[model samples]
Target: MLLGRHPCWRQNPAFPAIKASTFRLRRLPSSNPSLRFAAGDREPRSFAAEEMGKPKQYWLLKTEPGEWSWDDQVASDGGVAEWDGVKNKQAQKNLKSMRLRDLCLFYHSGAKARRVVGVVEVARQWYEEGDGGHGGGGDGAVDVRVVGEMRRHVELAELKGDGALKGFALLRQPRLSVVPVAADVWERICELGGGYEGDGGDADDGDGEG
Candidate 1:
């Protein structure tokens, strides 16, 4: 991940200041590079259990409009629905690991423009929904419910343009479909989502992120 130019600030004359808290997930030495799961495997651990008996981790889930829309989730018989059809090994891993109460950032992809539209909560644990693509079965899946929508759509361009999101994994690993959201990143995004008061333009009251 490279730090590109910020339109708001000019290049400094001296050495640039680097944020000391930036995190990077190091790849473990392995013979294989692929992160997908093999046939007949179970889902990952529950993310909800990882936090204070509450879902603290944040995540982003991408779905095409033609397939499933945010409105579909909201209009469902109940707010909760199963999240399936995840074939990618890594994405499966993320879904399996998600806790029932985890927060998800709903994104619309494969369209004219990509944007994060709403927030959803994980409602069920990872379980094998049905027969996977292979003759085998037990693919990982999750259940989610639409919690709320962003006041303004957070476009990919805006996400790429934000200086505050320089270290976000969503920007760093765009193709990772499902990714972890650090606590700091989660709070920052909540702040970005209009401070969770339905007000999109209010500045933080000097309370810092979260």
Candidate 2:
């Protein structure tokens, strides 16, 4: 089922709106041994993000596993695929705001599937996309590539129950297909998904399967 057909996403004002992300990264601790910025050493890869003067952003995009499962996403040509079928106004804005390299949580929604199963990177920004017959009629869409599966999946109940995530966008706007994810919330979820191992380096988003 395309996101447009997902029953839970039908437009309704019952849910509260989540604030848009308007912040950017200012500094990264140089004390971490993993990131050596000492005198003569070459800069680490993450330095570019800091140089750009824009804080990295995170998002959560919900999809039904039966319609677009993790396997399907990982196998998409070049490990990337078009993310369409969002009609919610706020969700459309979220898609448009995405920038290259932005990270997103791939969430599965439905009967027994409300969980964050993996991570993906924004490979392309939003563009004009026609309704591919799914009836989303959304403002636009973006392209995402599989980052990797989480070491552990995070369930909706867990997120809702965690007092730290009381301001989480997912819980606040349950009906939106695409929602912004606060960095802290992103880190917390990553921790719950089995440590903060998103780079796939010491963990899995790297060249190896998670």
Measured against the true structure, the TM-scores of the candidates, in listed sequence, are 0.63, 0.68
Global lDDT of each candidate: 0.72, 0.82
How does residue 163 of candidate 2 score in lDDT? 90
Off by over 4 Å in 2: 1-51, 133-139, 195-210
Q: Write the per-residue lDDT of candidate 1 for residues 57-174, one digit (tens) a residue.
A: 7899987766677788778768777778787788889888887677888888775758888888888878776765211343657788777888767778877787878878888887
Q: Could you give me the TM-score of model 1 versus the true structure?
A: 0.63
CA error at residue 17 for candidate 2, angstroms: 74
What are the runs in model 1 whose C-alpha is more than 4 Å off? Answer: 1-55, 131-138, 195-210
What's the lDDT of the predicted structure labeled candidate 1? 0.72
The C-alpha RMSD of each candidate to the native structure, in angstroms, is: 22.1, 25.3
| Residue 133 in model 2: lDDT | 23
